[model samples]
Target chain A: MRLVQGNEAVVLGALAGGCNFYAGYPITPATEIMEQMARVLPARGGVFIQMEDELAALGAVIGAAWGGMRAMTATSGPGFSLMQEHIGYAAMTQTPCVIVDSQRVGPSTGQPTMPAQGDVMQARWGSHGDRPAIVVTASSVKDAYQMTQLSFEWADTYRLPVIVLLDAVLSHMRENVELPPAPPPFSRTLSPDVDVEKPFGNHPFVPFAETTRTIVTGLAHDETGATRGTVGHASEKIIRDAFNRLNHDYAAITQYREYRLEDAAWAVVSYGITARAARAAVDILRGEGMRVGLLELISLWPFPEPTVQSLARQVQGILMPELNLGQLILPLRAAVEGICPVAGLGRADGELFTPEEIANAMTSHSTHAERRVSHHA
Target chain B: MPKMGEDLHQYLRQQMMPTVWCPGCGHGNIARAIATALEHLGTDLGQVAILGGIGCSGRTPFYFNTNAMHTTHGRVLAFATGLKLANPRLTVITAMGDGDALAIGAGHFIHAARRNIDLTVILYNNSIYGMTGGQQAPTTPFNFRSTTSPFGNIEPTFDTVDLALAAGATYVARTTTFDFAEMPEYILGAIRHPGFAVVEILSQCPTYFGRLNKLGDPPDMLEYERNHTIVADEESVISRDELLGNLPVGVFRQEIRPEYTHQYADLCQARGGAYRA
Candidate 1:
């Protein structure tokens, strides 16, 4: 175990997980990831390229992936925004890659160095088309390492872009992280001879076990890679099957951690750095003889909805404290479906939520009962 | 150029054609020229990767039998950079239009030239956006009419050869469909040149640029190119032709440099890393 910053841990994990190619442009809170990658990649038989911008960064990552390298890029909010088009292209062409968005407060660079969970929705809907995204949030330095490696595994497995969301604070904070023993269970090492994957085949984009005439494009093309232009049969199948592939296997992709929730009357749902406070709050509430527990979300998209639904049936209410003005709560409420009251505690002041702050909210909600306000509509 | 006749079918994807280029379009001529160039090189066709941006030129990838990727507009060079570095053995080529290379993707273009990566870039300079129904392009002649520039374009044209040379391209050439017979010599030189190589083919968009500027029919445009252009044997494209309002057509720059991918492999080796690329 070594004490490493969140960004440093990401590089350690990505390299350990066999990311052979990295392309990036510097942005605040995420520059360390790129800087470290450049320093270490070349020395370790990996390639690191400093691209012109975030658009070219992700573009190069996709190109490298097709060139049979496990590729990735690091960015914050503004850079993440620039990568949306390529994200859609990766989806359309079914390229396997990882994009780590160390999010900061932003409409356009609102608070460059401050942490904000404002990108929660954009991570899912940033691209133009209807495509499913696998987003995993990191609550600590170690989680950052695990989630970054896990993003690569799931990207290769699902044949789509997997985004790992880390906030400014979590990205910089250091911790004694014990690297996962033996790389995330499913991490893949591509062979040297693999040039391209058969994009439309049953086993898609997995380091070309067989050369299948790689003709990848962002356009809606048939199996032979000819442009269909209209959303005809090929486009129709692509769009229609986009969600089903991930949703049906939701159990496998969705990963989370539950803390002290058995026989609890209330549950606080939070993720990333906010979960640290929520965990302390749950401990504080339980010490005061209140049955409150914490459900720390690790994966943001392909959300653990069934688990949230089961918690709703078990608890009287759910209180969610977030770093933004309530983004993930939309899907949480959809999962809860009015089974219980769901309230939100949002902080966008570029500060972490204190344990007392979240504990008091849960205490007040448990007593007032009439103060139940959930965006059920 | 060895018989671009029925034998050239080995280099093409027969089913995807009839190309999306218009009737009497010069993009097809350039595509055939590239095929003959690849055919002449006689390398394993599977080892080549043809990439294109979003335009009439972008569709060229679908017609090649090699490993192909149709990338985003103006960003194919950036993609090719990563691709070539990833697998240095793969001979990479990118085809882009004026708007794709100069207007939107200008940054990537100069940087690719600056790095001098081992990739052959073909610019089908049609002077208008043919796929998007003829908008004013960066290569569009000064005050030449286009659909977007209905009142006649006031913007100055980007001299394709000068731009390539200034941007540090080691091997740069400008040819037109009118000079089709000589096109393969420059293309073959580009493919073998061991660094960033650019061949800017002044292709005809008879359907768009021809119509907007009243440049007569496709044959008339090709004939016009033959009449107006001078064979460039001088140090600079503008040395003698600038006075005649004529563009130069020939291989203008050919120099040697350490290709990006080769240097990357050397770096990996020097660092005692396991990278064999």
Candidate 2:
């Protein structure tokens, strides 16, 4: 239990989740994470390196992870863009690690120190191909701490890269947060020894000639870590198995918080910094006797899909507010299948949504709300 | 020479053979020098890891029986830095060609040397892009003929040893493939040196550099390297005009510097638990 800034919470969460090595090159709004980690990690018998650039930072984190250390790196929008290729490599290699993106506005080094959640879609599909990842967002300082802790756990649990998506608002905002005294839950698995000499045996999932140990390289492999070209059953199995871990066992990785949903006919599902505003707005609506619920998503990817779908079926509509041009709303609409009309409230003006602004939208006597509730019922 | 009395070819065949370099290339000689150096040092094969970048020289990891990685182009140093910091037990070595080390990875090369990272960089300089056609490279020597520089190169070449010394490499050495015996000693010394050792091997690329410049066959290129290169000395003086013809070769510098990882560990020790306190 402590009063801390959102950036401080993220740093504490990283330490609590057993991140022992941090390789980062400083970028604005994200510099606090690096500064805090530099101070905190060393005290906990960890390592911190300020790399020459974003590429080396990412490269070092990946190497450190392979060297059997829980590692991490932090960046903002521009630096995050620079890290996409290595992020893809981490996904393909199934390297367990975490990355924190304190997003700022950008196409090319846009507002360096200002807040914007413009990277919502980029976080999901930044890297090449269909590599699924676990993305969590922090709305407040407390969420920053808890969600970052969750990020590392999810990364290590599934042997995949986890992204802690923080916009400048939440990343720089200060608030009181009650952190759990003890460390959070996590599990790090060891590679099953398959005898390096025999390399690939008669394994069903992995193919022949692939190395026995985890190769940890970006090259395509047949599960045994041997480089295999894109062809045949090996390719199919690799893709299928990787996605199975993402889609099927994905439910176990989801984290979210629902507020005042009983008998609600409309919901505002949001993530990152905007969720704080959404929660405040939902409370005002609830006080005014409006049956509005807020689903504050903690896990941004493996996106509280089942819970969102269930709520969309029962609710008349969903209002998703974000800092970007409605990146999360598109996915919500896709999952809801028009069972509910999804309305988007987005502003990329480097300003956060005010509680008054969000409440006005929710409690408006819009005729569409009346028609939607009646039609759904 | 007597201490290492075994035949180089036989020793190579027994310990590391079936070379991974492309046929008709000079990388085999570079590989031979590296292997010979390790043999000279009595370095255990199990404890060494050859971290390689993407290039012709990057394939050096495949021929060696040591633990190694064929990392992405221009990123071997980053990976090697992590490996050395994590274990501090493995002898991490990076092998990269001219373009791989100097062009795409120039930033990393400079920083690695400046920080005095504990690793060895075996920079193979053949003065032309060999793997992806004979393109103009940072080390493609001024006015050298190549596919990209068909009319002749306008950019001046990088003297890798000089660049490394300027960038703070604790040990810096330059040797041509023609000086096989001395080349091995340079490699050995670079590997055993305290921090950020760089041994730039002036290699021959008969197919690319040789064919383009009409340096004749591989033997002629080797003979040219032997005759034209000078052993650098304290009193040695050459005019800028004379420098165009002669490339100095030999151990140019060696000094002990505290490595980045060790210094970082010491920082951790000094900060104590009061870091958070």
Q: Please give the CA lDDT of all the candidate structures.
A: 0.85, 0.77
Task: Tell me the deviation in Å of residue B88 in model 1.
Answer: 0.4
- Each predicted complex: what DockQ? 0.64, 0.33
> Which residue ranges in model 1 land beyond 4 Å of their true spot?
A180-198, A206-211, A228-231, A368-377, B1-6, B233-242
Least well predicted 10-residue stretch by lDDT in candidate 2 chain B: B8-17
Most accurate candidate by TM-score: 1
Model 1: per-residue Cα lDDT at residue B181 = 70
The regions of model 2 sitting more than 4 angstroms off are A180-216, A228-236, A363-366, A369-377, B1-20, B233-244, B273-277
Task: Please tell me the interface RMSD, in Å, for model 1.
Answer: 1.9
User: For model 2, which pairs clash?
Assistant: A210-A226, A211-A226
Candidate 2 chain A: worst-modelled 10 consecutive residues by lDDT: A201-210
TM-score, candidate number 1:
0.94
**Candidate 1 lDDT, tens digit per residue, A7-116?**
99889788766788999999999999999988887777788899899989999999888888889999999999999989998888888899999988877878999999
How far residue A219's Cα lies from its native spot in candidate 1, in Å, is 1.0
